[model samples]
Each structure stands twice: as structure tokens, then as C-alpha cells.
Target: MNVRPAEPMFVSVPPRPQRLLHSEAYIKYIEGLQADSKYISNWDKQLRANTENTPVPDQSRLPTHWLGNGAGNHGSVVNALWMLRDFMMKDALGINKTI
Candidate 1:
């Protein structure tokens, strides 16, 4: 038997339970738990930043502007996430690993 990493595999589809709240976000949260601390924090930061500010994609600012600051949970979520940096660095460097 051989397993080829690049070989295409087919999967059967299963319908999700109708009662689940946020199927995608829940999956993302779980996947983050499986990753290292660096990946979890940095990935969240990257995703939040990459989110589009305007409906017209790149037109909100320049096509290259960093839109992370105002992606909007009424402007609160982004602020709170960045605020974590005030107490400690995201890398958790020089601190206990269990932190």
C-alpha cells in the first residue's frame, strides 16, 4: 500500500446539524487550538487584518492599505485584539510556555 501526498482524494459530503451556530468559525477556532501559540495568535491577527473594510474590495483605501485597524465589530474587536499587546507581546517570549 502506498500513500501519495499529492494524489487527489474524494470525500463524501455530510450535512451539518441545523442547530450548529457558526459552522465555519467554530471549525477555525478548533483548528487554532491544534496549532502552536505563535500560529494561533499570528494567524488570527493576519486574518483580522486582511479582512476588507469596504464593500468594493481594494477601494476602501489604497489597494495596499492595511485595513486591520477598522475591520469593524463596531470597531471594538480590532481595538481589543491589538490592546493585548500592551500587557505582553504576542510571541509570549521570555515568559513561561504555559502562559
Candidate 2:
């Protein structure tokens, strides 16, 4: 049985693009949220500046209640802060990789 060279088939497969979160509508929503008084903060301002001229999608900011509650609990906040600092140092600065 002879297979006639697969008939030189031309497959027109479209490329599957990655779905990035940074769309124009999403960017507009982020800008609007940044302008809102309830969510605006120094960090938010900085983030707005950084993201304004770029295409990076911003993560949700920590809520005000979280900050207030964390501040109200001294020991827990301290522990959590230290843990976060260490985590950032390790993951960002590549200090510790024992995970």
C-alpha cells in the first residue's frame, strides 16, 4: 500500500495570542480607581506613575481595613511585617532559596 506523499497539505493555523490583563478598558478602570479618594494613597500614587506609561497590569492594593487592623495588632503585625520582608528579600533579592 502506497501513501501518495500526504498531498503537500498546507495547514493555515492561526496563532494563539496570550491574554494579557492590560487592556484599554481595564487601564481606564484602574485610572478611575486611582482617582477615587477611598482608594488613593501614596503607594497608589507611585503605582499610578509607574503604570501610567507602561503596559504592566497592577495588582489590587491592600485594603484600608487590612492596614488598620494590622496596625491595631502590634505583635501580629510585627511578625507579619518581618515575614513579608524576609519573603521579599528571598524571592526578590535571591537571598534565600531553601523553599
Compare the candidates by TM-score and give the number of the best one: 1
lDDT for each candidate structure: 0.50, 0.51
Tens-digit lDDT track of model 1 for 1-99:
988688558777898878856776678778767544655445445544423541333443332233355435545444443444433454555477766
- How many steric clashes between backbone atoms does each model show? 0, 0
Q: List the residue pairs that clash in candidate 2.
A: none
Q: Which candidate is the best by lDDT?
A: 2
Candidate 2 ranges beyond 4 A from true positions: 1-75, 95-99
Candidate 2 has its poorest 10 consecutive residues by lDDT at 55-64
lDDT of 1 at 16: 81
